[model samples]
Target chain A: MIEVENLTKTYGSYNALKGINFRVEKGEILGFLGPNGAGKTTTMRILTCFFPATSGKATVAGYDVFENSLEVKKRIGYLPENVPLYKDMEITDYLTFVGRIKGVSAKDIKTKVSKVMGDCGITHMAGKLIGELSKGYRQRVGLAQALINDPEVLILDEPTIGLDPKQIIEIRQLIKNLAGRHTVILSTHILPEVSMTCQRVVIINEGRVIAVDTPHNLTNQIQKAARIFFKIEGPAVNVVKELNKVKGVKMIEKKETSNGVTDYIVELEKGNENRKVLPELIIKNGWGLHEMRSVEMSLEDIFIKLVTEEKGVKT
Target chain B: MRNFYLIFKKELKSYFYSPIAYAVMTIFLIITGYFFYNIFATFSTLSFQAQMNPTLAKQYNLLNISESVVRPLFGNVSVIMLLLMPLLTMRLFSEEKRSGTIELLLTYPVRDIEVVLGKFAACLAIFSIMLVFTLLYPFLIKIYGQPELGPIITGYIGLFFMGAAFIAFGIFASTLTENQVVAAVLSFGVLLFFWMAGYSISFVSSSLVSVLSYIALTQHLESFAKGVIDSGDIIYYLNFTMLCIFLSLRALESKKWRG
Candidate 1:
């Protein structure tokens, strides 16, 4: 639904986006993850035709963003980071106005506005002024405005910023519901939001895309060594020494318990599976292995590692 | 055309809902009415045959009837508009920039000209409504005494063109800054220069002085106010308005590239 190639934006000597490239398939929810000022907003703005890229090509719904911006704009609904709204306008009136400007027929604007207001759960406040709304309600109103046009592509930048936890969950659920109907490109600093709501994640840092893949794949790719945890009732010092003797076991750390139990974290070489021999080995050593579990790296760990690693190499 | 209509309607509604438009209009009416009444009272005391003070006596003589009172009624219209136009337009683009709504607006499928024209038309519509109310002065003159209808209509045409020119300049100034106060001050400064340009040109006798007078917006307006429909004067105001709107469009378009 969206394709960006060699997209770059420069402000004098400062390069806000440098040759960033990414694409989103139809009906796919793609999350753009980055820290503050990581060019996420810039990339989204360029894609939405709000700004022209200094040197790049971007197309949305088969329309070039710069060359055929009107077509691109007609097909995409954009919710900027700050949720800009006319404070004096009522929620319903604003949505209707947006629908009209987006080329919805005059006959359909009323129905479309109401449908979006219901979808975003702002029907109750439809008659109230936008400026009088709370942050969460304002964000919902912003979302409703974007959805009023029934756009084929939705570009939302930090859709849930400044909302409370409950509001965040509600908005995340709303975004998830929008999948399969609207191709979504969501940019946010919140990692968990991307992990939970987006099927594909693109990590950008310092004006460049550092990683792009499924959240699960990113974690698996970054986890170089296999680690396992074991709770054993045995001689603590001997258990640590015995675990080190197992083949493919590169390192082991054991913690002694008050009840003569010991816990150990065993690290194995990459591509090695030691669980098959663990039972036999524990029996042979006369150590009672009460609990055993594999430790898998999470998306958070991978994200931190990737961002920090990129930072380290830069310096 | 539909997109322009949508934007125009929304912009017009916004003016009525917000206190900015009402406040500006109220203050404008109060100031204009005060000055009109004061000028009329001072002239009423002078003899109808007094020709020494030609401008003041002529103004009084023109105010005798309702429909022909446009001369004195619109004499102070420019000054009233000078204060109100900036207030009405200060938030046109500045508020959008400050609140980040400009991004949302640009993302729609409307052309930049459509947006500019929509906003310009909305402000012009409101200014026209205010002008309609000032018609009461001309009507009052026609009721009380006889006055020339030709000059009255010409005076109103001049007022409309001047207001259009001022509105365009105000919008251009608004686009240059994100702060409404700064936009208002800058618009005021620009309008002040244009209003004073004709008088200032008198001090200069160089060949450039005549060219500058042609460029001055008030000089063109002065001809219309005196019952003249000069094509050159009409083209001057139209060109000035178009120039400002074109510059504003460029400013808005540059934002996308700078992003």
Candidate 2:
């Protein structure tokens, strides 16, 4: 569990974290979604006790990060941005070293190292030097280092960055598996990564937290109106007039017309079953219905809209 | 203590894993060995001259092998250490900071002092090994002639402490920057300034002369090299080493304050 209350970090004239607040429940995987220079790494660094916050408090597992940093550090595993690692060390050796510093018992270090290597899918590269590995493997090695101690809390900054698409999927799966066992707070600029892996998301921008909610709720809260994409082979002018006459049909914008088919995006009022009404309306009009699908706003759209300050709802 | 040991082991292992340690040790040995040979050659020539002439023997006082050869050998080794210890310690913290490994290292449960001491111990260990290799010079001298054991032992103690102080300063320098070359050059300059500080005593006011001499790193080594183990000199080197280590610890802790 982690609690950050009004945590502010300032560097000279610039503020990296402007009194941001968030809480992550035990075994909950919280995604810290923000664009570049948005204080994600700075927040993670303060939580990891790499540095103390300029103001306010952050507690991990009931220990204050500033007052009881050693205890917090003992219970938390951090994978810093850039995945810093001793490049000359072998994979197993590096993991074992981290395990030792993380306070794993000497007798259990071997098992822990092997287990994490397996968990991160770097088992075959155990004997290879970290410097010799490719970027993806190096990223895995960094993850393995963080998991070596099996700490109660895991703080990962941009964990999937620089990995190939396949590696990224594998890592996301690995992190998703960690839910309900280890409390995870991973930061990323990638929007869908939050929707796919995190139970809740915290969207931050310009040193301030803009919104925090479940990925699904964020989309629903930001949409305001339902949008449906429809293709119909009908007279465009007459179809628009008839659709406007239907109750709860707010607007219909003609997207494009080609090959005698017109693509229309219909904005329907909330709680309206315009989807059920549209097909009958087209049939009565003697028009062939080509395609009809509701268009849900993806997390990507919500992210951009929130970050760009078009719409936001704090939870 | 356990944290210190773990960090120390990792640091020492890293040194051996990289080429810099081997390169520094070999270069240190080769250069020191050359100096040792030259000093010994000059001593041998002087002794041979003394043997051929009684007046020269009385004038040169060639019977004190410790003074003529062992003491100067230690002096040369100390100078060699002054040059090489920077190379050994430049990467201790600078490379970690440069490669961004310091982030993970600092976040570990280990205390800040433990990291500084652990790194200090590792560099001291490597310097000790280099010192051990130089024992061959004394061993050869012992085989060919009789050297006083007192000065040999005392000189080593002096070299050990002096080299350790050099390493501690180098570690502090390493902490000040993320650039290895900058760390190395900065430490070398600081050490050379202190080593040359004693020479400026005559140029300073009488009241400031003692201060300059006391702070000069080389002045403390002479007492040990001369077979006189003054507690004052011992305390000076110990305090110097501790001050540098403390400075390094503070530099490391500054991250929490300023970051």
Candidate 3:
């Protein structure tokens, strides 16, 4: 539904998007995960035809964003960051305005507005002014407006930034429900948001696409070395040194110490089966073996690892 | 045109939703009403004297109610519009830019011209409503005295076009900044410069004086105020309005690249 190739945007020597490339298929929820200033918003702006890329091409819904912007725009709905809204307008009024401008027919505008309001769970706030709504409700109104046209492609920049925990879960579930119907490209700095709501994740940093894969696959790809957390009742330095002497042990780092039981993360070499040896070694050394468990790599870990790894490679 | 009307309706509704429109209208009506009363008082006193002394009436041109009262009323209203138009148009684009609503607006399927014209038409509509309220002046003149139809009609035409030109320039100024006050001040400065453009004619050479006079906003309204409907003045105001609207469109278009 969206294709961006060599899309570069520069603001007078400051490159906002440095020739990034990505493609989103129809009816797939693609989570654009990135840190601040990662060019995610810039890329989405280009795709939505908010602004042209400094160089290269972008097409949305099979129409070039530059050459056929109107056609592209008609098929795409955009919710910008901060959820810009007409604060003075009523909820229904704002949604109707968006629907009309998005080319929803007059006869259908009322139904479409009501449908989106129901979809976004903002039906009860129909007659209230937008300025009177809370932050979460305002965000819902923003989402409601984006869905007013029933657009084929939805570009949302951080759809759940300021919401509380429950609202975040609600929004995530709402977005998850949108899968297989509208092609969504939502950007967020929140790591777990991608794992929870997106089918595939594209991690970008510093105007570059560093990794793109399913959340499960990303964790697997970056989990080359098995990590085990060993809590032993002994001196931390001696336990780490003794663990380092074992075969296939890549590294061991002390985590924390409390009541003479120390927590340590031991990295094993790929294909190493020394999971049994570590506990035995602790038992044989006269130190008490408190607990032994393998730590599964999460999307957050992979995200930090990959971002730091990219910075390490650059330096 | 459909998209333009959609935007126009929304913009016009938003104007009434905010207090700026009411405040500007009230202020405009109050100031213009004061000027009208002052002009009417002078006209009434002059006519009372003219009834007593016919020679003085001829010398003062008090014989024509339209000349003594209606013409000055239109002129005063035009000046007042110059001051209030900036307030009316300052937030047209500036508010959207500041609030970041311009992003969603531009991303919609509407063309650039549609957005520009929609906003321009909204401000023009508000200015027209304000002008309509001032029509009470002409109606009052017709009630108490005989007022010439030509100057009253032509004077209104002049105010309409002149106010439109002012609005276009105001929109252009609004697009240049996200700050509403800055937009208002910038447009007010531009309008004031053009309002006083003809004043420097006497200091310059005769050849340059005619060019300055042609460019002056006040000079074009002179023909209409005198009940003279010259195509040249109408065309000048139209051309000025078109140029400012075109410039506003270009400025809005440049925002895409400049972003």
lDDT of 1 at B144: 56
| Worst-scoring 10-residue span by lDDT in model 3 chain A | A295-304
Candidate 1 runs further than 4 Å off: A225-300, A308-315, B47-70
Tens-digit lDDT track for model 2 on A1-315? 899999999998899999999999999999998878989999999999999999999999999999999999999888988988999998887888889988999999989888888889988877899999998898899888888888899999999999999999999999999999999999987768888999999988888899999987887789878999989998899999999999999889999899889999999988885678889999999998999999877656776777656344432
Q: What TM-score between 0 and 1 does chain B of candidate 2 receive?
A: 0.97
Indicate the DockQ of the complex predicted as candidate 2. 0.71
Better of 1 and 2 by DockQ: 2
lDDT of 3 by residue, A1-315 (tens): 788899899988898888788899999999998878889888988898888999999888889999999999999888888999999999998999999989899999988988888878888888999999999999999998888888899899999988989889988988888889999999987667877888899988788899999977887789889999888999887888888899999988888789999888889988985888888889899999888889987656877899889889989
Fnat, model 1, is: 0.94
lDDT of candidates 1 onward, in order:
0.85, 0.90, 0.89
Error of 3 at B128 (Å): 0.8
Ranking by TM-score: 3, 2, 1
State chain A's TM-score for model 3.
0.87
DockQ of each: 0.62, 0.71, 0.74
Instruction: Give the clashing pairs for model 3.
Output: none
Query: Every model's Cα RMSD, please?
Result: 4.6, 3.2, 2.6
Instruction: Output the number of the DockQ-best candidate.
Output: 3
